[model samples]
Target: MPAIVVERLSKTYFTYKRPPGVWSAVKSLFRRERHEIQAVRDISFTIEEGELVGFLGPNGAGKTTTLKMLSGIIFPTSGAARVLGYVPWERHAEMQRQIALVMGQKMQLWWDLPPYESYLLLKALYEVPDDAFEKRVHELAEMLEIRHVLHTQVRRLSLGERMKCELLAALLHRPRVLFLDEPTIGLDVVSQKRIREFLREYNQRERTTILLTSHYMQDVQELAQRVLIIHHGQLIFDDTLRALVERYSPSKALHLRLEQPADAETLSRFGRIVRMDGLEAVLEVPRELVSRVASEILQSLPVYDITIEEVDIDEIIRDIFAGKREAGALVNTAGS
Candidate 1:
């Protein structure tokens, strides 16, 4: 069964508009102007059990809003969603027990208290047995390599340590579904990589379904097999990362190191030149013509070594958000 199901789910926020002036503020009390902001608009998707899906979008692209709705923190204005077979906004006890939401900027752990204390409180609330709780905490702490800092005060821990503790707290009950919003934000490269490794291993070992939102393409590239991209409150694409690249990016990059120097005019005959430095050059070639172009270049030019690489996923996504590329048929309307 699917771990999460969202059908035409939407969230619209309403706020009173006020101009910057004492007179405007005073007048607004008597006559207010209400404006509607469509935070999430008729987005639909499903994540199967044990599938780790990447939820992607630029700032204000409804990524966090959608997660909040699915995690029962906020209610959607329209449509329906089910997490672990329960309507999330209903805040059912069973469903809540089986799911976890971790936002990088938010803290559930007590600021002055040690993370161990917070874990104990969570254990009590979750009704975990003493033995089971102890084992779970030890196991998770060991896995996260934070056993040395579990007793340190939350405020005293470094940002990376705090994030690891936050993740531990969220996973204490061994949730079947996890919702992570920028979990690696503000983390160092080492911390980010460690957390990614832990999440990948945990998802595989526990068979937990995860929906992760991150600005770091490396996180999605290394961890998720499928990605859902939202833009301007609408889901623009839902498919494998490979499909995302293939459909939106029609070109491949060829890096070549030549035995002899080549001028721009000579290289232009093969493909669009992206860069040239001495005997080394980077060319952009149509995906369909990459092989032929590479063969032609090798035969015609003084080629020492040549390599073909797909357009960077980061560049492809950037183009999509910048309106340089269209989603078109890549938008998965069925949302399955």
Candidate 2:
């Protein structure tokens, strides 16, 4: 069975509108003009059990809103959604116990108390057995390497440590489904890597269905096998990361270190030069012609070392959002 099923799910927010004037404000007391904002448009998708999917988008793209609906935090304006075979908005106890939601910016742990104390509260709330709770807490804390600080106050913990503790809390119940919103946000590179490694291992061992939303491309690149991209409150792409790069990126990058200095004019014959600095140059060439162009450059130019690179995922996503590339075709092709 699918872990999640969303069909034509959408959320519209209604807010009062008023002109910037004292007279307009006074006149709006009895009657006010209301404006409709589509936070999430008609979007539909399914997530199978044990799949780790990446949810990607820029600011205000409805990524969090969709997560909220899936986690039963908010109600949708239209359509339907089921999480773990239960209507999420209905907030069934069984479904609630089987799923976990963690947002990096929000803290469910108390600030002044130690994390262990918070764990006690959560254990009671989740109705976890005593022996199971003890085993899970220590295991997660040891894996996250936060065991030494579990007794320390949460406010005294570093940002990375707090995030780890958050993960420990979320996983204490052994939830079958996990929803993470920017779980690595504001964390340093080392902390980010550790968390990613831990998540990858945990997913493999537990077969947990995870849906993660993050701005950091490395998080998606290293951890997600499939990606779902939302733009302007709509899902523009839904496919594997490799498929996304293959379909949307038309060119490959070539990095060259020359044995002799070559001017930009000399390199222009081979491909569009992305950067030219001293004897090192970067070029963008058509994907289909990369082999031919590289061969010609080796035969013609004074080349010391050359390497081919796929277009950066970050650049491709930026182009899609900046209107440098058309995503309408992608939506049509992906049946979004």
Candidate 3:
């Protein structure tokens, strides 16, 4: 059986509509205005044990709302979602002990207490065996490089240290499933890298199922092989990372450092120039004609150096939002 199963799951939020002005508010006291916003619309997917799936979407696209539903932080409006055979929204004790949820900006640790105290509280709450809890805490602290800071107050730690501690706190009971919502947000490069490595090691060692949501594509690229994309609360794409890249990023990038600067008209024949500054020009060339564009640029321009590269996933996604590309159509054509 799948570790996490969500079928026809939908969540609609009731938002109160308050009119502007004091008179309007007073007049509306008798009857309140409200509207239901469909945040997650009939989204269905399953996650097998040990699978790490990335949820991708723009801001206000309902990604966090879905995570909340799956983590028992909020109730869904309709449909079924089972995590390890227990309804997630029920927040059953057994289910709660087997899973963890870490939000990026939210803190699970006590602000005034030392980080270690927070873990101890969770240890009692989860009823972790004394010996097992001690071993796990030591191991996780060593792995996360937060052993020295365990006694430091949470409010005093840097963003990165606090994040590491939070991670350890969530894993104190060694959950079989993890829901990570932007767990690495707003950290320095070294801190982010450290957290990423720690997560990879944890996943490999525990074979724990992870469902992560992040606004930063770098996090998704580094950790998840399967990605589910949602737009406007709708499941728009579900596929392997390679498949998503192949379907959406059909165009290649060509960079040229011309010995002599060229104008728009002079470079228009090769492809759409996305970046033009000084002596360098970056073009978005169709994959089919990448070689042709390269050769033509080499033969025609006073080229210093030229290279071709795959367009980054971020740009491809931007193009999709701009109506410049469609992965669904691209995938269909490729399959045919």
User: Which one is best on lDDT?
Assistant: 1
Total clashing pairs for each candidate: 0, 0, 0
- lDDT tens readout by residue for model 2, 228-293: 899888888888999889889988999999999998888999899999999999999999999999
Residue 334 in candidate 3 has what lDDT? 27
Least accurate 10 contiguous residues by lDDT in model 1: 327-336
Write the residue-wise lDDT of candidate 1 on 221-261 in tens digits.
99999999999999999999998999988899999999989
> lDDT of each model, Cα atoms only?
0.94, 0.93, 0.87
lDDT of 3 by residue, 1-336 (tens): 788988888999998888899988997897778899999988888888998889888888889999999989899988989999999989998999899999998998999999989888998998888899889999999999999999999999999999999999999998999999999889888998898898888898999999998877888889998888888887777778877777777788898999999999889888998999989999999888999879988999999999899768887776765667764523222211
Q: Point out the worst 10-residue segment of candidate 2 by lDDT.
A: 327-336
Top candidate by TM-score? 1
Model 2 CA RMSD to the hidden true structure, in angstroms: 2.4
Error of 3 at 86 (Å): 1.4
